[model samples]
Target: MSQPSSRPELTPRFCFNQTALRDFLRLSRSTIDDSITQNLNALLTPSTTAFNPTSTSTRSVTPPSSSRAIPAQTCTSFKHNVLFPSWASRSDVLDYCAGVATSPDPDDPDSVLRQIEDEKVRERVVDERLDPYSGRYFPREARTESLAMLMRNERMVEKVVRARTGSVVGERCGEGGGLEGEFDEWRRAQGSGRR
Candidate 1:
């Protein structure tokens, strides 16, 4: 008979399937919840000082300075140990929601929440203009009109500035006909011509 093979047969390693992953996640969540509850309870309760067997003194030992006395009412919310959703547990999200709900400047037109709400309403109104494929809603016609209005306001301001200053600061020669044209005319009158 041939000698027995020196190398051992290879065996497949165990891998976590979807069910195993889910079960593990559930167990971990339960463990974390239990730990949090225990920690909170420990914080609320008064801790006893450890006995020093080596010392002969009869006086009671005091608790360490690190142990703080948590107020009873503060621990009430954590007493039930109900697990909140991830977003609800976040302090910033809670603060923002609270701020929006109890906004001091509710009547102010420039309030951030009011602005966001107005934008949301506008988006809803123009929902028909949304592109299904791209998932983008661009009211191009409205945007163009708004841009034109802004440019017109800018040109009007430029005209007023030209009239007040009598000299263009950074205005292009071809665009505004006020200061540029007048300056060119003055140069021609002086026999220097356009530079």
Candidate 2:
């Protein structure tokens, strides 16, 4: 056998798909229905009105689908509780931010500090959970992501911001309005923390 090189060649890896998993575990529609019935009896109730066994008048309750057709407000609440725990409620967040915005001077050091804390809270909420199943925010904080993918996404965000603002450096382009001073203060505060 030839001597192995200092750096071994990387080989691609394969993961089993869901269909393969189901086949391996012998999962079928009947099994899935049974599991669902066991798991969601409170949510899915069958009509229990008694009739003659010979009569076909027995009614059944249909289970809600995974689509979760609940209202947007309900979904937002679920996201707040399950996906975001940093800021309490959306209204509270908005009020706090508005209070900071309407301050005598947004560029004030104290107000900048408060805004930085608020942004840090928001960042924690977003980064803590990433749901792969629904391709939405996942509540499991321990789950990790690839560094390369994270870098790519960060670069993409920088590109989008540049495209929107039309400036990678220099003073605000007039459209940013008076908020520019507040933004600069916030960025300075963030940068100072690292040093």
Task: Kindly report which residue stretches of model 1 are placed more than 4 angstroms away from their true locations once superposed.
Answer: 1-141, 167-180, 184-195
Cα-based lDDT at residue 97, candidate 1: 28
In model 2, how large is the Cα lDDT of residue 192? 92
- The segments of candidate 2 whose C-alpha lies over 4 angstroms from its true place after superposition are 1-145, 166-184, 190-195
RMSD of each: 32.6, 26.8
**Could you say which candidate leads in TM-score?**
1
**How far off is residue 16 in model 2, in Å?**
19
Instruction: Give the 10-residue window scoring lowest on summed lDDT in candidate 1.
Output: 7-16
Best by lDDT: 1
How many steric overlaps does candidate 2 have?
A: 1
What global local distance difference test value does model 1 have?
A: 0.35
